[model samples]
Target: MVAPPDNDVLWARGLHHAHGGTSALAGVSVGVREGEILAVTGPRGSGKTTLLKCLSGQLVPSEGEVWFNSAPVHTLSSPSRERLRLDRFGWIDTEPHLVPELTAWENAALPLLLRGTGTRSAKHTAVEWLDRLDVGMCANRRPARLDQSQRQRIAIARALATTPQVLFADEPTAPLHRSDGTQVLRTLTTAARSHQITVVLATHDPEVATLADRSLALLDGRQSGAAAEAAGSSDEESRAACSLSV
Candidate 1:
């Protein structure tokens, strides 16, 4: 197989996946440019999450290849992929899966701590990101003590604390109100851009898609009727704003 381009942080070719004989992805191919935010937009059951999982090495494709910084990710063993995720990739799931027992700062520092960073240093970095996400005041609160949006912000803080090479966020704000989601999305893209982190954001909202530098839409587990980056006529301004870096 040809090597991925040097500037493409992540690449996938001819990706396909199936669950219990049902197709989740069909012949999907994509390239995420270095330091750029790429949106994977599609409706529910449209293959967005499956495609992301395949590309991120969280799930192996039933067919085809995945590369990370030109390394053969799909070809790696499960343990190797786990290490890759621990050391180089960060993920934000739809739910803010914070440990209920841990304080906000502690929850955000979990990843860094798991990676063996000193506790004091990890807490400092975690708090700094919590502040950036505008959740600094909640740093001492536990998950049960915070609202959905606050918990989500701490989750985002956790993902950013390590400053991983690539970040994958799957319907990250699905549980929040529109206004709350918008603000979190804005903060996420801004942080990703400022840190030069490549982001692959999965969402079903048009407004959310607008924040990405480029977008790929899926339909019934396959490419849609239009080309990649094709936006609705109403989103012209949003597309043009792609270069705004948030």
Candidate 2:
């Protein structure tokens, strides 16, 4: 399937975030396009995660604007934002927040069930995603009983189960070893492209950065001129050279 136009997903212009004396992101502008995986990479406290939050509408930007499908997200009402978050966005944090007592399937089904889908249908959908992620064997296992990699897979299944239009993942492969991390990243990008979901991942891993269609680096809460230019450049040579090296 053809990817959606760049304007169809999230767009940020001159976005900034600050608290006390620190800046998270300064004058950051980027676009997340459907079927494209955008990676945000930076050092600790560089505002990678903060940028993700602003784009996902978890945190309002201190300056500039964030547009979701051409609509300014910050201008939307609370209920409208919540509705959009529930139906259109999927977020996966660094730590998988599965319930200790609930089985993997149950954890994956929670969102669908909360949306009023029948229990049977929710479980069915959850199992399908679990299977797709090659974790169906853990369907009945609780988070406490699963390994870190297993937990990560469950998190991925949950994120994709809803088939959201936008997927925001923060350090999705942070806990895994190199090989496992690559596998997980591949899984996420493959699923997203197949479903035409726009993906934005905040990570410090070089492998993750290399896999992204575009990469942006945040330094001391600001994007370097070189990085910003790379992010804005359309030329293939420039894009490959623009990726964050470290």
Candidate 3:
């Protein structure tokens, strides 16, 4: 397993969210250390995805704050937030977000191109990651033409192409068969560690959780009592001294 970096990469302090009267997440606080894998596991409606959105700056928290490398994500300008997300954070949703018209390689290279990398160089890096993930054969195939597992692999390859500081995956194995799901999870986790990227995954799969260095369970829009207690006890003494100085 890759060691967590000396810096804190992501943190959520007293995060809360709601939709109408329903609470999606309440007082959820967690910190993801650089280069570590933190798995969030919970039942449906447990706010795992909501927490991810808040941390990624896609959705603002209702009553709390999310910090990325000591900067409040919600306070950044749109362009700045977007640049941060693109350059430092990588997100992989359950469904593949590849463009239907673009081939897998093109889709994977899109982010790099957006960040000013030349087409040839970005495509070369994309192809290299695809090869690493064993999806090189699908490089020229459009997402519509690839099977579910192939498309998922392409999405992961795209996420890892930039060597992001933090990688978030939401139920990455939801659409795959048991064997394929395991393979994808293993590939993603291993690659993240090899690159020293912090990984935060939300899933209900026990097998997936087992791969994490730490796992937290959520229930009814809040982390489970036991999980919360453990986090408090273990993380407080070690992390409190280094809380975001800003």
Candidate 4:
């Protein structure tokens, strides 16, 4: 097997995956440089999430290769992949999934704690991320007490507290109001840049994709430049109509 490029922190080639006989990804290949923010754009069902999952080692593609830091991720044993994720990768889901029983700070600190970090250090790091994400004031509250945006922010803090080398964010702002989403995304991107973190962000929103340094668009589980352009035009027309509505 050929090694990935020296400069790419994450790389994949000829990826193919299917779900219950339906293709989710088809011959998808990508590379992400260290500390670069790459936005994966497409309408729903365009394989953005599947690609992220494969790259992040959450799911092995049925066919193809995935590499991280010159190592072949697709060939690693399941336990090794799990350990790699726990140690070096972070993920933010479309919705907040904080533990209802834990305080926000505790929830944020869970990853470090699970990794055997000292309790004090874990709390300190978690609180720092919470403050950065604008959720420090909610640090002591349980998930049930926090609003959706606050909970989501806490979840982001949790992901950031570990300071993983790579962060996968799949439509992270989908659950928030546009105003809330803007602030959260600004904070997320700013923190990632400042920390020199590699980010693979998947989003359907053109505005969101614009924040990344680069973008890769997909359609029907395959990369398509023309389809992406057409989709962008359609989205712009829809936005114009929305602006004209009462």
TM-scores for candidates 1 onward, in order: 0.93, 0.87, 0.88, 0.91
- Model 1's TM-score against the true structure: 0.93
Candidate with the larger TM-score of 1 and 3:
1
Task: Please give, for residues 1-246, the per-residue lDDT of candidate 4 as tens digits.
Answer: 899899999999999999889999999988888887788999999999999999999999999999999779999999999999999999999988889999999999999999999999999999999988878999899999989999999999999999999999999999999988977887887788778789899999989876676788999999876223223434334223222111
* Candidate 3: C-alpha lDDT: 0.82
Clashing pairs in 3: none
Q: Which ten contiguous residues of candidate 4 have the minimum total lDDT? A: 237-246
| Clashing residue pairs for model 2 | none
Which is better, 2 or 4, measured by lDDT? 4
Candidate scoring better on TM-score of 3 and 4 = 4
Candidate 1: 10-residue stretch with minimal lDDT: 226-235
Residues 1-246 of candidate 2: C-alpha lDDT, one tens digit per residue: 122245657888888888777878888988776666788888888888889888888888888888887678866777878888898899998889888989999999888987899999999999999988789999998999999989989989998999999999999888888898887777777777767788888888756777667778778778753333233445355334333221
Candidates' C-alpha lDDT: 0.88, 0.81, 0.82, 0.88
lDDT of 1 by residue, 124-230 (tens): 99999999888999999999989999999999999999999999999999999999898888888878877889999999997888788778889989977433453
Least well predicted 10-residue stretch by lDDT in candidate 3? 237-246
Which TM-score value belongs to model 4?
A: 0.91
Clashes of each: 0, 0, 0, 0
The regions of model 2 sitting more than 4 angstroms off are 1-8, 225-246
